[model samples]
Target: MFLTPAERIADYQARGWWEEIGVDALLRQAVAERGATLALVDPLNRKTLDGCAPERLSWNELDARVDAMAAALIALGLERDDVICAQLPNTVDAVILFLAVARLGLIISPIVMQYREHELGHILSLTDARAFVTVPTFHGHDYAAMAAALIAERPGMMLLTMGAAPHGADLRALAASADPASVAPWCAAHPVAGGEVLTICWTSGTEARPKGVPRDHNHWVLNAKVIVWGTGMQPGDVLLNPFPLVNIASIGGLMLPWLEVRGTMVLHHPFDLSVFLKQIEAEHVTYTIAPPAVLTALLKQPQIAASVDLSSLRAIGSGSAPLTPWLIEGWAETHGIEICNIFGSNEGMALMSSPIDVPDRTERAHYFPRFGAEGVDWDSPVSAVMRTRLVDPETGAIITEPGRPGEMHISGGTVISGYWRSPELNGASFDGEWFRTGDLFEIAGDGALSRFYRFVGRSKEIIVRGGVNISPAEIDELLVSLPGVREAASVGIPDSDLGERIAVAVVVDDGITPPDVAAVGAHLAAAGVAVFKRPERLVVLSALPRNAMNKVVRADLRAAVLAALES
Candidate 1:
């Protein structure tokens, strides 16, 4: 199922960015070296995803469970290259299932737990998944019924349930019943190649149907190495992961790195502030990742901040929104914790600003030093692997000047070859050897060794007000600095005269009065924002609507404002 070009693979191997080692080999090495060491801790008790109890596993135990499960899956007629669609939370079972699929040389497609019949149907049909795994009920949704409905339509598909198995096979029973003697030999017989596709992860699908991004073993390994380089994670460092396992943040950023370093991973699902803080203190967590808004929200709540001991934290990674300079600086100045600004995607784009790379907190918030820029080499290993360029969106010419917005194009070992089964998307997404990121950025700094890149805004996300392009990120960044603002999202609303008008939706601190449009305009003016870029309308909400990945959904916000005005 691997689709990477042979020439690209040769280039990556020659540059030492990738090797022939796969994830299964890495896991086996970790088990051999640290068999008795704690490998995973699941504190959520599966209440959010299922009604199962809490789980803890050592390296050896995790390996045994994965082997047993893999053997059971093989007995059920699942073979190498067969797609297993799994919709589970960040639990021990999810991790075990991932490893089992890798061990059996099978392809696993992880679906976010939030997906319902509409999204699941499309994914299952597209992938032709042989086996589907889910919890009977999660967050009050009856997944069994949904699976039953789908399985009825596709009789060839097999269903496997985690907590309760009313419609299909019982996953827990299958694992428990598999004999190790038989399982070990079966796994050994089916050897997995490092270049084979390991998983198919889905995109956010904001504009159209979600596109599947298939990543191979080398892709995951190289990505994990990049994270290890940027964060400087050492062996035995405790990591707390709250991100869903379906995406790159978890699989590449945390899970695969944990395997590389043989560290303990504490998993948390359904992000609760109290639980997150407790886990950090209890697990002696040295690193974790969070959205910028969550980091700021924690700072605003002094009571919560004082309740837990965050002294164990050395660094925190944040992205998915424009980071505020204050939030990054305040954590370092007050708590002695560094915030690493990470910009990544499922397509294999990774840009990071670490404490060693960008020591100044304010600079870390807005700029990422171009990895392979001329004369800008750093100690980071990823810098040697990644290549980046910015091109004028309209003219299709490369941009070199500072402060000129250009769409970013990246090529690297970690980047995916193309979207799964979507030749049209692949055709539109790639330009020669580079993958079009659809992100707008401007080069910054002067000297050759000091060149950096600043995120502008998503090309499609720019608000067009009366023919002038307005960057929503610029407005949101300014608004977030306001005293009472908790979070802000700028979106375009339809107007009678102009095709669109700038509208700002804000979430203010509890008991604080929401700022009106005039007050917001004054603030923007004082900040030196041009008049055309000023927001024309303001709406206050308890919280901004976000997707599972913590990215603000501008389309939803725009629809809400339009509905109110029309009503």
Candidate 2:
């Protein structure tokens, strides 16, 4: 099931960037050395998320449960190389089941719990997964019933639920009934390899249908190194993860890093302030990645942030949206916590900004060490192994000059060779071994700082006002930096005179008077924003339209803005 060519695998292994070992080997190493250490902690509100109490497991206990779960899957007729699709919350069972599937050389495709029939149906048809794992209900959604309906459409696909289920086998009960060591012999006989594909995670698909991105275990391990080196994670450091494990942000940044460091992994349901604060205090968490909005909220409301002792956190990672320079500086000066900016995709682009790489707070907020590019060098060892290039999208020529935005193309042990089962996407996305990231970036530094990349905006999301090209993300970040602005999204609205005009929808902070539309214009002018880049229309909304992944759906937003202006 490994998509990597034999030559590529041999090359990476020879270069010492990858190994012949699988994920199970890493777990075994941790279990053998730190069997008594706490390895996994479920979300504190797991009972509210699912219908069962939360469970914590030490390394030894986790390994034993993985075996039992693997045995249960085998009993249900799952075999090596079989694809297992899971849609569960951030719970101990989800983590354990992923490991158990990996131990048997099975490929897992985990989707967000927010996905329903349309998304799940497409994934099932594409992957032909043998098993579907989920919970019966979470956040008032009948996920198990959704899984049952989807599985019914695909015959022979077994359904396994973490909670009591009327539609499928109870995975928890099955694992409990099985012998803890029952799958040891089978695992030994099969013997997994790191080059084999371990998972197929899907893209956020804010614009279109999702595309599946597949990566071998070695590739994931290599990507995890970015987090390890960037955050200075050490053995036994506590990591509180709120990112959904369905994607690279969690799998590479938190899960694999936790395993590599033999650390305790504390799982949190996404965006639960009380649960998150409590876990950080009680678990003594040293590292975590937080949502961009949550970070901004804490910065705006000082009393809520001051209530907790944040001295334990050494660093925090943030992505998905741009960070205001003040947010990064605020966390550092106020709490002494360095906020590392992580820029990556499910398609294997890894660029991290850490205190070690980019120490200045404002620099960390906007710049990423240009790892893998020629002439530009960085302290991180990842720079030595990967190769990066920025190319003009229209001309197809390599871009070397600073301040000119271009599409990023990267090739390395961490990059995926191609998308799963999509010939069209593979053709459009790959130039030989280089994966074309639709992200637009420019070289933004001087002297030693010259080796840095500044995110402009997604190529598809750029706004062309009259003849001038504008990055909406640039304006969005500027708008968010202004006081009274909370959550902001900018979109291009069609105009008869100009091709498109910039329009912004903003959500103001609670209990504060909303900033006047004139104040917004004045703030942008003071920041020196160009006239073409300034918002032609502004709307104050209670909330912006968001997709399942919490990404602002710019298309929907544009429609909303146009409708409001028309009315």
Candidate lDDT (C-alpha), each: 0.82, 0.82
For model 2, how does the per-residue alpha-carbon lDDT over 1-567 read when each residue is reduced to its tens digit? 879898999998998889778888889999999998899999988878886688889999999889889888888878888999998888898899999988999999998775656557778888989989998888776778877877887889999888687889899999988875668788879888889999999773222345688989898778767679877787788999986788888899899999899989999985588779889998999999885667878888889888988879988888766776898988888889888888877787788888887788788888888898988767788786688999999999998888899999999888998888988868887998898887889999556556889998766766755323456666676777778778887888876445567788888877877766677778877764434456768877778999999978877888888887777
Q: All candidates' TM-scores?
A: 0.82, 0.83
Candidate 2 has what TM-score?
Answer: 0.83
Q: Model 1 over residues 1-567: C-alpha lDDT tens digits?
A: 667777777787888878966789889999999999999999654554576778889999999999888878977988779999999888898899999898878999998776666567889999999999988887777888888898789878999987656788888788888876666676668677667899999873223345799998989988878898888788987899997788787898899999888999999988787888999998999999887667887778767878889999988987766687899888988788989988888888899988888887778888998887555667777788888889899999988778899999998888888889998878888987789988899887567424689988666665644333456765677787776788888888765335468888888877899888898888876664556667888877777878999988887888776665566
Best by TM-score: 2
lDDT of 1 at 57: 94
> What is the alpha-carbon lDDT of model 2 when measured against the actual structure?
0.82
Residue 191, candidate 1: alpha-carbon lDDT: 70
